[model samples]
Target: MDALVGFTGPPSETLLRSMIATLMHRGKAPGEVFLQSNHASLARLQLSDDHAVGLRLDRRGLIDGDVTLLVCGFLTRDGTESPGGSVALSGLIAEYRARGVAALARLQGAAIVAIADETAGALHVARIGAGVRTVFYGRYTDPSAATSRWLVASEPKAITSAPAFQAAIRPAAIAQYLAFSFVPGSGTMLQDVFELPAGHAVTLSADGSSNLTNLFPFEDGEWDGRGDGDDHSHWVAESRRVIADAVARRLPVGEPVGIFLSGGLDSSIVAAEVARQHNHRVLTYAIHFGKHYPNELQFARSVADRLGTEHHEVMVNPRQFAPRLRQMIWHLDDPIGDPITQPNFELARRVSQDVRYVFNGEGGDPLFGGPKNLPMMMQHWYGVPREPGFREKAYLASYRRAYEEWSRVLHPRIRDQIDPERDLESILAPFFQQTSVRSFLNKLMAINIRLKGAHLILPKVERMLAASGLTPLAPLFDEELIRLSFQMPPRMKLRSGDEKWVLKRAYEDDLPREVIERPKSGMRVPVHFWFRGEMRRLAKKTLASRHVREAELFDPDRIRQLLRYDIEEGAGRYGMRLWMLMTFELWRRVVVDRDRTGVSGGR
Candidate 1:
């Protein structure tokens, strides 16, 4: 969770310090700032002393005469000493020095790199690989100066710290967030602020002009050739080898590592691989919502027992963490309406005490087909009058978040500004329309990996774990595994009615039969019961508050109707909608309203 913040403008120590202050939670160590006549860059180092071997190389940046390089996450290469630190920085610098920005495409692992070239009068920022790491940039114009300044950081809050940067809410993004539970593309909830997508780069010039480029486009069908043969065993063997290698690359040296085991196929696969390779102890953590709600602990325990891992099961409920809601939202930076956000944060808090690194099975569903793809596939083949945008609409509805209720939930003023076609469907249009990816399933996988995996799943996990001072290692999300998924045929991903078929076949012997055979009932957070029980009062008070009404973003009457479960259809499903509303309001207080007092004691 170390961060980098910089701007293209006349050097001002105060401006740089202010931005760093907002991100102090990311790292308590004093920030190191590099300044020149027209640019300033700051790095907030957060790694503990035990992991500081590479601090000297790029903790601030690898500075050459006219060019300086800064990286916020680890980078890896074949036979590199480690995934990150001095060796990685040395390798990265060499590549950049030789190939310039093109070197970023050759880079692997999860990282965001920034190269500032004083001679070229340009600053380039790129997110490497599968977008496990995030970088946000926004343009801020100083009233006193003629030229606009571009502000960039690891999180959006840093950009908002500048006084001149306006943080107006983008209604269309909110609509998208409701549909996907997270904003889909580069656009965030803020108007001017944008997230750099995976395999994309942006360059900022002195004159305030910027150009965005897609560095590695997944839609290009480059990986299709890998799965060209009809021999299924070859793919299964190749998948097993590639996945093992991915996990091996991520295993920490001389230290215990933890896995967020849900007893699901993804986490189990990761755990089995880690246990197979690591010399150190393997710890697995699972969560349940007390005995009142259905739990996955049985399956998780079975896997843990099979692997002989030191398993720990924790129970999280609304009553225990409600007071920290605002603090959690603050950590999220962007609102993610998924109910599991709190549980992820809580689990990280526990895991942080035992290990600095944690691994999870995050990419399996998105990379290979998962259950969510089934409904869309069914609609694609069987039910539907063929119509334009049918795929987009069906995909949006599959999330089952707030998409159907977005318009009803938003105030008319907010709704008036949003056009679903321009804002919502447009994001998915390019992927669906791209003929380069021949299979419809692969196209869905493209959207899932690029949009959901990059934006929602990876960012949410990274932020929550980073809050607890832990780094997440997603072996499944490795760049190699991502390409492998695309290379393998669509049927290899989802065969007959089974999802992630190849993944299951790859680890069939390594994992328990029950774990592999069971349908993926994901870590289901009991939001419905919480709204009727523990979180009921809190939801009622927050949504009905004057501040929410004054903000003119949500319809108060609709919120009340949702709270009361007054709607005839989808009655019990209002918990997610309410959670999204509450998360946005709390986020508004911290980021938009700048209400520091409201952030503490989240009641």
Candidate 2:
């Protein structure tokens, strides 16, 4: 399951066999599963009987010629056939073959998909837009577009592992990772290799000509003329139906499941639905970062008590954070700056003990517009002047402060890439110019869908699969759920500074209003306080290490200055900067520097 099939050109029969051997875990099929092209570089997967239908090009309406394409990932929006994925993909492929041109459509599931058309002498590779499945492609010779060699893979580590290419760091992405605590867009921690953007696809012609295309076009669909009818309950009832259906489908019978209950609105909604439908008590897990971070035990216990389910909570310590920090860096494949990764990794480690399946509230932000961005969004939407309105001005002021703070801490090379003047253009410049209010909201959705959502859910899921063979079920990440959020009016999303206002109303009967109305408190890790206290020495030692200072990518002097200031001032601003540097150093040591001895803890 860890191994992914991708190469530069068409492979020999022996090479095809070797690729199949790498996937030794997949069981034997009734018919042939793996298919490769002698003329074109292509491979096809036959994971199930339905997948067999997708593997058969003859049955497919496309030219009925020999084209070996590996269709990875699920496409569920087309219909409801359990894994309605292969059906949607096959239909699109047949449509393209018949038209002999580009075929663009919205695919609901997370996948790293590649298709080769031998007859047309072209190949197409893509990651599902809002990229649930990881896809990476890079160049061997030059970083230029023409000299690039493309490889769409599921794991960043797999692409990094290619012996032919030296995995170098992208400093700009590293800076962004520090600021947002997650990499934005298609860029990853590794140089040149990019995660294909959500709602976008890249096509490589058989003649070696390449073009990247955006599949989902943003349209400002609205109902301004029509009144809301003031029926909030309708929105609530419909959301319940959609969420309940989505969860029920993902859970396989006779299997013990786990829910990452944060006692927040989103997870509470999921827990409520699970209790209503599922026969067994869904094993619920929570994370605590000592007393410094907000403790959700009391809130989570209330939800657990109401649902009559078993719950588990793991209190993480500094020692656990240090080791698991290195472990997550390895599994995450990309460098994400978020400290929440520590709590998530710890949660997965503990959850693996009780169950093999876990559900988390990843898509909640994008779906319901969680409290993080609500204050600013509400002010602007209601036509409040940016400088005069209290909420609007306060929000803009905070953003400007964050930008200035980030600018000061960032390395010059990274600072050069981002324009501070453009950065301060009222914060809504990017949203207004390119995307509609709805479309801009989708950008936030797209960000979480690609970065924060992927960072929080996928890495833990990957470790669970690698260690205990657990499968994570994220219903919020479901295609139907995303589409629902997109379709819902923005007014319902953040009314009166309440984040996830629509979600709360929808689950009102199922969840206590107190639980829904309470300020949002997801899993929190006290990395800032930790860096200033018990782990202070560890932080200093790691930043000052020879390996870190000598890493070819970063500026040694700049690194030293930032570390010195943070240690002396005890400001958490430098803690973020240090975490980004430390994660990169750890990644370089574990993933890139294999033969070294002192590669354990950076300090």
Candidate 3:
């Protein structure tokens, strides 16, 4: 629930103080520091327990005699830290000693660790895993030294606002944003502000030299995820235990809590486990879109009634979209094209009034596989013109819009500027390479974990929940459960055309068989269908508005054509595409045009 920011320069007390003020725009700012020699500055936010934030660990720490570390996220330590006890960066160095940075592997939670060595005047930064918590670094300069300085922060605004890095939009990042509906890879919209991808680390020297490191490289080794034997029951039993423990640890100590029960297998399973472990009727919340959309209220309520839990439900409509769109994007710095984001936002807002922690089945699909995965795998294997990157493009193209369609979607000017295949490979290739000596299913899962989860899903949840003043705990995304998930053979993940086969089996008796066996159509938000009818005027006005034209980020004629087709012959078919365009326009208005009021309301 907290963010961290730091700079290494002839410390401008002004900049340090400004960063603290700007950081407050995201969360509470209770921490700030600057070395007397004007070498470093730091700021941190400690969120209250009411937000239901997980791993309530402090960020500013001194590593014994070696380094000072500013940690943005939490670390699932080997043992307790004196019951909410926090260790200084120096204390960690003293505790772990020579092991020092190597002990970071013991970290099971999300974190962006920015460590500065006092003895050596050197710095090291790393991200713990593939979670929403991220660090963006960019080089700025101190006029006095004529040397390069750097700014790092959990949010890009902290770094991008500085004179050194904030200039204009990065075209390549815009191209990727236009392509994937969000900025992917290391690049952000700001040309100089680069995100540090998960499982990677960077080292900086006082002399202005730096190098990047990959914490977990497949080349170093491979984990087959083999258990004691080929026994299916043994694997299922282990899956249950690991997932159960992950869920249990995430719940609040003695405060009210709830699970986002969509009655889908993942949330249902999480709810059932909470009931089993806590021996109480856990509070559950589910989003109920009105009729004409796919509603899982019956399934969700059935699970709730069967578990004997306090149940709460909230409804959403297309009318709420206009006001919340910018606020949602503001919450999510990088706009996720998914329409369900707003619904989750409202769900978090409403549920926060009743519970501090809200657990959801967010990572289940990426780990255990999901329905949409099978077709992508098929396309990857069966795609024609199978060049070096075609399979990767076909499999990982989240937009699912054909490359041939790009010319018509984006203008020839914008479309020609981007090399779709090249962009796809740039983002997908690195993770795909890690699949060496692994199953194809595992390969896809790993790619999704590194790409989709890290970029789209996890960040969306993290920001929206924070904006709603609630913490999101995805047990399925728990560090150990994710690692354990990889160990299971692909067959267990997607077996005989059944997605999450092993997970379904693990929860068969505990959850209703109908719920477990039902074909998974994950939380369908009827936005596409509504856009064709109820939301059409709003969609058209937003997509074809003058503000969008002023931005000139897209082609007007192409947008008109798409809108015409979607409104006429296409109907709800291109619903996802329409939503993406609308989302980008809204984001452009807010982030580029400085439309703060567009993002006014939030927790």
TM-score per candidate, chains pooled: 0.94, 0.80, 0.88
Question: Relative to the unseen true structure, what is the C-alpha lDDT of residue 36 in candidate 3, on a scale of 0 to 100?
Answer: 31
Over 328-406, each residue of candidate 3 has an lDDT whose tens digit, in order, gives: 7876766557778889888887876776567788888888888778877676567565567765666545455323354
Q: Write model 2 residue lDDT over 84-144, tens digit each, in one string.
A: 2234445666766665334545455545556666666555676554455555555443232
Residue 84's C-alpha lDDT in candidate 3? 31
Per-candidate local distance difference test: 0.80, 0.57, 0.68
Candidate 2's clash total is 8
State each candidate's clash count: 0, 8, 10
Best by lDDT: 1
Q: What is the lDDT of residue 122 in candidate 2?
A: 58
Which residue pairs does candidate 2 place in steric collision? 10-41, 75-85, 121-206, 122-206, 129-198, 129-199, 130-198, 236-506
Q: Which candidate has the highest TM-score of all?
A: 1
The better candidate by lDDT, 1 or 2, is 1
Lowest summed lDDT over 10 consecutive residues: which window, candidate 1? 48-57
What is the TM-score of candidate 1? 0.94
Q: 1-603 in candidate 1: lDDT tens per residue?
A: 577788786776777777777766654344454545445454545544324312223444677676777777766653344544344455666777788777777667667778887877888999988888888999887665555788888878788878666679888988998888899888898988989988888998888778877767655643555535567798899899888888877677688989999999999999999999888989999999999899999999999999999999999998888988888887788764888989988888888889878889999999889998999888778986567887788788888988888899889998999998888888999988888998888988899889998899988998888777677889888877777787777888889989999888889999989999999988888888888899999988877757667999988888778878898888767878888888888788777877765363221
